[model samples]
Target: MVEPAEFRSYYGRPILKEPAWKQPDVPLYLFLGGAAGASASIAALADVTGRPELARAGRLVASGGSIASVAALIHDLGKPTRFLHMLRVLKPTSPLSVGSWILSPFSGLAAVAAASELSGILPGAGRLAGAAAGLLGPAMCTYTAVLLSDTATPSWHEAYGTLPILFAGSALTSGAGAALLLVPSVETGPVVRAGLIGAAAELAAARHAETGLGLASEPYRTGRAGKLLKAARALTAAGAGLSLVARRNRAAGAAAGVAYLAAGLCTRFGVYAAGVESARDPKYVVVPQRERLRR
Candidate 1:
């Protein structure tokens, strides 16, 4: 039997430097972005469909996520005021800069839409805002993947193709969670359908990314990140499976919604952790490049 080839590194030291991001802040920000983006989409749909109550709930969720996302950003920056500097210019080549721009507009629109419902000021304006947010929301949801993929990390860069799809799916799932949790159960048809679609997409995207990555995918298969991702997949799948029945059962809807929300959070944290591991492991960085050069 042939033995697998062994790889070596200098003192087993990391080939690349780890990312300069902290826990809770970055991960939570990712979760909030997904939830916010998805909520914006749902809000727009609700508004267009004359579902006033659903629109209000979705707007509230979008605004809440926006607030949380900014708070996490401020926390990560070590100062609540430092985030102002990021608004200086729009850089096309930098995902971080682009994302910052996308977020400001999306957040502003979402908040306006939510507040308009209570204030009764320019109600039609709220609809327009929701429409704008709906257009921009998907970008807000997926740009983080671009930020991560553009980095020097091997696994993230290698999985760039699927990361956006995965994130978009997670965003939709989280949006559905917000609706199921906040909206009336009798009006959850749209949310349930969105959840099912997101669930299917996330599972397929994640599996596709893992299967195609070769040695670089090791970070996804080992350690805490791996375990978290596994749980995420399972939870997502289970929740998706329950969505059909959930349409008729409020209790089931609650359970499935919570599961989807948890799965979304887990997927974000897992991806961040896997990216960290990939950056910290010399084997991941060198082996892939070596193979590429050999070909």
Candidate 2:
């Protein structure tokens, strides 16, 4: 019987360069950005539906999350100018450049709308700005997934088909969670429904990504990544169930919201950890290449 060849790197060096994205910074940005984007959309919908309190909460979360996300991204880049430099020209082909454009304008618009909502100034313009931000919300939410998948990271690139779906679901749940926590139970009908749906979608997509990734999925199911993902799953499951009774109990809604947010954060960090592992291990790189060649 023929034996499968073992893959090894020269002098134990990794065959691929691991991503330079720092812990907490990149993952935090991912979570906050996704939440901000989805929050903006929720705010806009709330405004249209005449839910002023929910709209107010959504706008505030969107603005706060956007500013924080920008801060994290700038920190990761080592300088604000490095982030600014990307805005020199629009590049449809580059996910980074496109994301920069989307993030910049979305942040400004969300901030403006939030300010208007809070200070009762320029209500007309605030509505317009909120609507515009909402228009850009979805792209803002999923663009980061594109940016990650565009890289050479093995796990991220291989899961490209589902990463965006996963991100969208995460974003929706995070946004809904924030709203559920801040808004009162009387005005939380839409938010509760959204949270439940987002939780379901996030859980389903994550499971699908793990199963479909084959060997590349190993990092997601073992070690630190495994622990985070396991926590995320549990949190999401619990939160979804709790959200069903949220309409009757405000405390339950708030607790479920916290769970969803924590789950989303864990998912982002877990994905980052898995990608780093995939790049660091030569086996992840070589085995995939070998299998591809054989096919």
Q: Which residue pairs does candidate 1 place in steric collision?
A: none
Per-residue lDDT for 1-295 in model 1, tens only?
9997655567866678798888989999999998899888888888888787778888888888988898898899998667888989889989989989988888899888888877899988988987888888888889988888989888899998989999999989999987887777777888889999998899888887667789777788679888988999999988887777876788888888899999999999998998998888677877888889999
Residue 218 deviation, candidate 1, in Å? 1.4
In candidate 2, the residue pairs with backbone N, CA or C atoms under 3 Å apart (3 or more residues apart, or in different chains) clash, namely none
Question: Candidate 1 has what TM-score?
Answer: 0.95
Give lDDT per model, in order: 0.86, 0.91
Error of 2 at 260 (Å): 0.5
| TM accuracy, model 2 | 0.97
